[model samples]
Target: MTRCRLCGSTALESVVDLGATPPCESFLAAERLDAPEPTYPLHLRVCTDCWLAQIPPLITPEETFSEYAYFSSYSSSWVEHARVFVEDAAARLGLGEDSFVVEVASNDGYLLRHVVDRGVRCLGVEPSVNVGAAAREAGVPTLTAFLSPETGAAVRAEHGPADLVVANNVYAHIPDVIGFTQGLRALVADDGWVSVEVQHLLTLIEENQYDTIYHEHFQYYTVASAIRALASGGLTLVDVELLPTHGGSLRLWARPEEAAGEPSGRVADVLAREKAAGLQELSGYTEFSARVAKVRRDLLRFLVEAAEEGKTVVGYGAPGKGNTLLNHCGIRPDLLPYTVDRNPYKHGRYTPGTRIPILPPDRIAADRPDYVLVLPWNLRAELVEQLSYVHEWGGRLVFPIPELSIVEVER
Candidate 1:
């Protein structure tokens, strides 16, 4: 009788278990070196009542992003993605000078910058203090507070309702999914649409993307599950599109539930596909645990053999996803040595469970490692470009996912 995030429905069954994992951004301190890192149950379950998919009830949003270090602008791929999204959303919405755009979790104004350029009034609602400050400094009007029903009401009282709301990759991070969507309901006008991007749960299970599991990610979503979740908060899907971001994701366009439009062919098609794929049945997800177990075995084998061969395997990216992969795989400082990050905040901090020091990208050039273990597999291409200097030394890039192997040429 597991309760669903959308409603208080107790019709959930366990689907996948990613095992015990440490907090993604819980960097260790020198004094706490010997102290044991807190590990939480890393399991994803599907709510049959509401069709929503999420991790077990555990950490809060404040516990996750209040002192967050992973800023969106640090990664070029993400920044470019934001720019493109803003352009497409603006055009699709047919925004004009009078229309307003609001972006939830708009870190460093990566996406809002484009909205601002089109003479469309734009504002950002970001909870993280540091990231919000960065956005304001970039001339993006940002509110530095958490979004709830009260905050949404206060915002509307000041600036009226928004016409376009963008919640990119923030759907999975919200602690109170229903409460957050209710805020969106209050913050947006009747004619407006909210485009939300959540990591696709179908992709996570089907592709064995267990590495994406972490406390920061409160929920993984499928199109069917998301539509149901939004429906609970008085919203309905206007359209939906499958996205390739973060391995696999979905961009859902939803509006107020009252004024229902003709259902998109995309919606019915995916529903039929999921039904054919047995989404409603619990047994369909039972094999996810076994798939995860195999991944753990293959990854450990690769890392151990590489260490024995005297390969200096440095890690790329200090992402939350990378933390889950490293800690779950039991990689310590002996095997990984150090990881490089583009952000200055995490450069000196050590990873949570593994306690491996995080250094700047310059470490790769200085150390001249024989092998670079790309932690954030989605950004492997960017890492390869940034670390092309290593190629001069005949170094190879390794991606440990689906299967473990080294890429000799540019992939």
Candidate 2:
């Protein structure tokens, strides 16, 4: 029996079994495709004790993130998101030149650049050397090490405690939930706050976002479970905000337990909402597998019908989430001939399990496919706007998640 990573409970109930899947971000080179690739069981479980939804760590962190391919600067909307966050956070926290900010899992300095521009001292803790080098080139000093309790203590010794520590979209990626939260506590000043952003478990089930389930993500957290995990590290939740990014994400503001701060009503409000949705009970999770299976069947039917009709279908954005959707649905190059991406690192490569070639955005206009499958459905609006020229050829966009639907482009 696999124990819960957070609470160490042995009573883990099965939620959804996605069979075996490769690491979502593991793009393959042309030569490597001929060789066998490693895949792990993509199964999720819920702990009755803590109510934390998680998957067992099949691959080690070194194997998954040492040479990361995803870069934050590739998406214009993501960069804008970072800029807005830095602006709002700096203003809200009263950050100045004297204030020190540290970002964990900082990718390419997409967010910290704004903090540096504001004259606040900032440091980034990044594990991927390639991405870390990019951040350094952009004038963001970064330490190329994983954020563990030991490393966090070393950072504190070298640079002093941070006035504000930001960990956006990285809370779920960590395998050691308790250790990671403790590390955050170690790095933050006594009075400073730690801001963590994670995709809400409620939104994941409501929207049928099963594609977000990949090997790198160790846990899916609800507001209540998140509060429990943070409290284990001697942190208290002070505030919470729901965000629209990544389907629906929750940004949590927490401080050391000894710190003087009252918990915001939003925290209780969201916790109550989760309870109303039956998230506190096991029955709330039992129906999810059926919903996910329906999505897979519906998407496959749409793709098979399109193929039989001799329609040329291609994919947009080779994101990790897209890989999960394609691999889970057993899609290959025949269904989606190829995909386009703005990130140069993924342009010449192929997706891990599906083996679909990834090309540059210019390929979409060159091919003028009859239908473009938007793989990263969360960014549908941005993609539709960028690929608007496809409408000139009477081509429509297809979204596979939350039910397969065809969207007509407005001329």
Candidate 3:
């Protein structure tokens, strides 16, 4: 962290230091609870030169994603989102039966299944052995490997150049930003489109979504910074869209420099919006730490008051972002008790650092907890509908980020 990862500059400013926490997704088995758990510093810094916000690469991607706890198909909304993206991308790019598609970090074939149904050949380059196996089981041709320059080149040589290279929600996961971007360049055709979706720094600051800051997410991007990162790999930004996923994200359409002419006006419009938000300069980040602190205080106060009043508060999802929020706020089982997730892999495991138990989603209705604190608030709409049954027991849902609010759902 002494120098910026993107620009190699010594001038890096602190956006927020969330103290230290374990790798967010490192859930513990009941047997390992007696063993020591390791933690690392989760500090975010912004480069004044490049305007790319990043954290120290304390843990490698292999350590976090090898076996992998997150499966994208578990979220129904995300699956539908991926489905729509596939159909739209195919139509937009004029893809057909002869077209080929490659998705980097494609988890569990949640997206490429759509490509297969469309009679297009597709390949998923996913690192995690287990999830990649799951993808292959679902009939999506997947290569079990990380998306490095070599891997990308090999895939290109074997399958031929992709007509469309899709990287969704993974651009910030790699520490080696330039190399990863180069891999994207290597996998795509000279004239093919590359679509990358990552969390936008503008929405992160404006909405106080500090919980998304974690070790796995090494870099945060504004369109201005993203353009620089893409250029380092011979890719050029062509279009941009502001998405509501992950609280707020940017879907960047890019291509090799030869084919990437003038970028869309939307890219400039978004960059102007980010500049207006003061992200290009240091002023945008000064008050962020304070806002983050306020979020911590408000959530803790609510949890503590609920505990004191004998009102039970359990967590809704044991997502990686939730671990950051829980560890940062110093919440233990006394405040949260246990959280439930639909993902069966997390069942009977414990959240890293906090050591709160993870249970099945049915446990919530069984226990009738007074309040369910949602960790994955990005899926608020979907979760609200799913958890509406809690209203039968007079239970409410709590969201921690962008200011704390409790919602009452109608059955």
**Candidate 3 residue 292 C-alpha distance from true site, Å:** 0.6
Taking the tens digit of each residue's C-alpha lDDT, what string does model 3 give over 128-190? 999999999999999999998998999999999999999999999999999999999999999
The deviation in Å at residue 17 for candidate 1 is 2.6
Q: What TM-score does prediction 3 earn? A: 0.99
Give me the runs in candidate 3 sitting further than 4 Å from their true place: none
- The best candidate by lDDT is 3
**Candidate 1, superposed: residue stretches over 4 Å from native:** 34-36
The model with the greater TM-score, 2 or 3, is 3
Per-residue CA lDDT of model 1 for 1-411, tens digit only, reads 267767777887887666787888888767787887778988777777766777876877887777778788888988888888888877887888999888888888888987877889988999888888998888889998778888888988899899988888888888688888988888898878888988877777787778888888877777778887787678899788887888888888899887658779998887777766677677667888888888778888877888898878898888888888887779898888999988888877899888899899888878888888888887766777777777778888888775677876442
Better candidate by lDDT, 1 or 3: 3
lDDT of 1: 0.82
- Give the range of the ten consecutive residues with the poorest summed lDDT in model 2: 57-66
If both were scored by lDDT, which would come out higher, candidate 1 or candidate 2?
2
In order, candidate lDDTs are: 0.82, 0.91, 0.95
Model 1 CA lDDT for position 360: 91
What does candidate 2's lDDT look like per residue over 272-339, in tens digits? 98998888888888899999999999989988999999999999999999989999999999898899
What is the Å distance of residue 300 in model 2 from its true position?
A: 0.8
TM-score of each: 0.95, 0.99, 0.99
Which model is ahead, 1 or 3, in terms of TM-score? Answer: 3
Candidate order by decreasing lDDT: 3, 2, 1
